[model samples]
Target chain A: MTARIGVVTFPGSLDDRDTQRAIRLAGAEPVALWHKDKDLHQVDAVVLPGGFSYGDYLRAGAISRFSPVMETVIEQAKAGLPVLGICNGFQILTEAHLLPGGMLGNDHLHFICRDQKLRVENADTAWTVDYASGQEIHIPLKNMDGRYVADEYTLDKLEAEGRVVFRYLDFNPNGSLRDIAGITNEAGNVVGLMPHPEHATEPLIGTGRTDGLPFFTSILKKLVNA
Target chain B: MARVVVDVMLKPEILDPQGQAVQRALPRLGFDGISDVRQGKRFELEVEGPVDEAALARIHDLAESFLANTVIEDFTVKIEEVAEAVK
Candidate 1:
């Protein structure tokens, strides 16, 4: 059976097609979910792609977090549905409280776009099962508001519980606390990261490295065996 | 009708890069005696009808849920009457 992965497209979404293509390349059917639509169409998993949703008004992801589709996404995610939020999607997840912490302006106060190296601190999450623990891989990271911040207690809890799934390896690009690049919820079903994995899934494309293919393949494999 | 002002600011513990950039530029621009700077957002909401408890409560809810993210920022809501001079 082919796994159906839904990719949500918001008004300002720029990477939804790339994310869908990545999923298709991984042998899964891509479902296009709209921001205003609440129905998920029974997708096996969902990916919120990157972009400046709602023009990043008020705050990045602030307006989009309240979109009709996110209402269902949040509920399903809490019920253990596998959800991956990339870049702007990560911002929405934080704004919706589906994930902890909030993003702020980059420490350098400039938009950063580059290939970022990250270590897979925890490979057991629903979206990272294919990677070995402590594996380092490069993915494209881009955005203006990418610095992640949280209360001290919350940061300590995330560290103590091993919820920090991905940590910046060589250099901290955005001044995120403890060099965190991505994280997973306590259930390990929902993951959020400020990187564009879809852009790196095809070697013939921009970076010419398929380091991000495992993210889609990992989730597809999970759904198949289940 | 009443004018409600919402002020949102990052928590002191969190780093404010925009504020820091401004602080650094102040000295270069020949300004001194400024200890620090913190950037924030302010929203002015114009509510219709009486400025009663229910309306104030609703505004508070908006500030908590949408106007501000409690994770790294705090928000305060101030209710001010319309000055007669402006009217």
Candidate 2:
């Protein structure tokens, strides 16, 4: 059976179309979930695309955290549903307490746009099973507020739990601790990343490498076997 | 009424490349003796009513959930009673 994956669209979201396309390319049915809608359309998993939601007022994801759609998402994510938040979506997850830590302004105090290199640190997560542990991949990372921040205890806990799914390779662009690039929840279902993986789904577009496609494929492969 | 001040900054475990860049630039720019520098922000708020405890708690939530990134930064919420509110 073809799995139905939901891609949420909040006000100011920009990459939802690409995410939907990536899902389709991965052979999964993409369902659009509006920020105002309460129903999830009975999808198998969810993806939160990135953007300056609500003009990024009062911090990047603070306002979006209070949206009606997030009310349902919070419930679903807590129930162990596979959830992936990219960039600003990552910001939303943290703001809603679905994930830990916070994303701050870029360390350079300037917007950064580049193809970032990241190493897969955890392969057990639903969003990363397609990639081998320690595999390195490149994806677009463009954002003004991309610095990841957290306390020592939380950082150590994430590392100890093997929740650190991705770590920046060679260089850390946004001043993230321990070169961390992405993370996942304890259930290996909820994952969040600062890089724009949706933009890397197609080969002919930029780097001609579909390193990001694995994220979508990983979830699809899981649903197929389940 | 009382006033509170909050200070927030990224934890040392997290790389502050910008801070390092600024520090590196300072020595070259002839700003000698400036050995260390870490960038951060501070906020102040005033609250009225008898719920000083509640107001302080709310401020901490605001700092943790919004103002500061608990992942890389720890925040200190300084709550001080600024004489009492006018009757």
Candidate 3:
């Protein structure tokens, strides 16, 4: 059976379609999920794509964290369901308490858009298995509230547990603590990052490189193999 | 009806670039001597009945769980008196 990957579309989601396309490109069936729907459709994995969800009101991903779909995602994720949150999705993950820390406005207070370089620090996660540890790749990073913050203790704990999955390479785009571009939960089933891997999935598109395609393929391979 | 207020602000240790930008502009605007500036959000909620201790406590919980992200922000909840309107 083909791996069915669900992509959630919140009210203001901008990248849900692109994420679906990326999943299709990776040979997985893409299931469309609504923010208000509590059902997950039994998808093998879920990808929370980037966008200004709920128009970024009450904070980037704050209000959307209470959406009905998230209620199920949160519960299932804890039970070892594979989930990937990108950009605003990352904000939602943090707000939902599925991930530690929070995202704040960029240190320079600007909405930055750029092709950013990142190093895959952990390749064992559900969404990163296709990449080798320490591999450098470029993904499109764009956001106003992308600066990641957490208490020193939490930061130390994440580092000690090797939960920091991705790190900025050469340049720190949004001043994330320790140049952390992405991280995973202890189980490695949940991952969140500020870059838009969906945007970089096609070689003819955004960055003209397919570095981000690995994210989709990695999850698909894991699900199919499972 | 009663009015309740919740104020949310970033923790002191985190960087406040928006506040800093305003502070930087102050000196050029002839408003000097201000050492620092921090930005925050204020939310006013109108309740249907008396905001008793129990209600206040509920609002506090709301502020902690929804109104504020405790990871990066601190919040305070309080009752606000409604001002009488002048005819």
Q: Note the chain A TM-score of all models in turn.
A: 0.98, 0.98, 0.99
Candidate 1 vs. true structure, TM-score: 0.98
Better of 2 and 3 by TM-score: 3
lDDT string for model 2 (B1-87, tens) is: 667889987676666666777899997898999877787768877666654677779888989877775655779999765765589
DockQ of all models, two decimals each: 0.89, 0.44, 0.92
Can you rank all candidates by DockQ, best first?
A: 3, 1, 2
- Model 2 chain A scores worst on lDDT over the 10 consecutive residues at A101-110
lDDT of 1: 0.92
lDDT for each residue of candidate 1 in A1-226, tens digit (9 for 90 to 100):
7999999999999999999999999999999999999999999899999999999999999999999999999999999999999999999999999999999888988899999999999999999999999999998999998898888898899999999999988889889998989988999999999988899998788578999999999999999998
How many residue pairs clash (N, CA or C atoms closer than 3 angstroms) in each of the candidate models, in the order given? 0, 8, 0
Compared with the true structure, what per-residue lDDT tens digits does model 2 show for residues A1-226? 6999999999999999999999999999999999999899899999999989899986788888888888888999999889999999999988887888878788777888889999999998999889999899999988888877777888899999998999998888877778888888778889999998888989997557899999999999998898
What TM-score, computed on C-alpha atoms, does each candidate reach? 0.98, 0.80, 0.99
Per-model lDDT = 0.92, 0.87, 0.94
Report fnat in order of the candidates: 0.94, 0.81, 0.94
Model 2: CA > 4 A from native: B1-87
